[model samples]
Target: MRVLGVDPGLTRCGVGVVEGTPGRPCTLVAVGVIRTDPDAPLPDRLLRLDTKLTEYIARFAPDAVAVERVFSQHNVASVIGTAQASGVAILAGARADVAVHTYTPSEVKAAITGSGTADKKQMTSMVTRLLRLEVAPKPADAADALALAICHVWRGGTQARIAAARTRVEEKGTRT
Candidate 1:
């Protein structure tokens, strides 16, 4: 499966695409950041994000999109912007008719580094090693995005199975 992972932020949204399945070595298809000037108006920044994300969806044609779930932050403004950025990613995936899933930061970190409390350096090192890249992706965001993609590729099947089991339970009129 081809998965597009989005680490969304108003200032620097990270995007990465990977193709693989559970137990298979994943290939890095693409990785980059989408930057919007802090001075730019909110609408303009969102528009830029929308346009670039649409282009990515069209180009990569991913089977699924894995977005980082926005968690509340101390800075309300930052949290709001991140939630908005995440919405853009979900919208783009919907428009492309691709499944969109959200993973918490801890979930992503644990999937990549075997520990939810892994630091950025550890996460970066693991991502570099997993992708077999000569060096870690820069700016942290890029590496985080790739890590998100790897998480989805590695965990998606199990997640899907769990969801299916829940659905079956619900159909049988059992409380979950």
Candidate 2:
């Protein structure tokens, strides 16, 4: 499966695409950051982010989009911006008729590094190793985006199968 992972921020939203299945090596399709002017108006910034995310969804044609879920932060303003960006990312996937999943930061870290408390350095190192890249992706945001994609590629399939099974069971129960 191909997945597009989004680490959303108002200024520098990270985007990455990875292709693979569970328990297998994943290939990096693309990785980059979408930058918007911090000084730009809120509406303009959101529109820019939305447009870029939509373009990525079209270009990559990912089977799913894994977005970093916005969590409460000390800075309310920061959290608001991130939450808005996250919504735009999700909307992009929905507009393209692609399945969208949101994973928490801790969940991603654990999936990529086997520890929810792994630091940025460790996460970057693991992402580099897992992708078999000679060098780590530049900027913490970029690396984080790749890590998100890798996490989803490693876990999303199994989770999807489980959900499908549950739905099937529910349907059968209702019919019976």
lDDT of 1: 0.91
Candidate 2 lDDT at 44 equals 96
**TM-score for all models, in order of appearance:** 0.89, 0.91
Off by over 4 Å in 1: 161-176
**lDDT scores for all predictions?**
0.91, 0.91
Model 1 TM:
0.89
What is the per-residue lDDT of model 2 for residues 41-148, given as tens digits with 9 covering 90 to 100?
A: 999999999999999988889999999999786368698888889989999899899999999999999999899999999999998988889999988888888898
Write model 1 residue lDDT over 1-176, tens digit each, in one string. Answer: 99999999999999999998786778899999999999999999999999999999999999999999987853686898999999998999998899999999999988988899999999989888888888788879888888888899889977888899999989889653
Q: CA RMSD for every model?
A: 3.4, 2.2
Clashes of each: 0, 0
Q: After superposing candidate 2 on the true structure, give the runs of residues whose Cα lies further than 4 Å from its correct spot.
A: 163-176
lDDT accuracy of residue 146 in candidate 1: 88
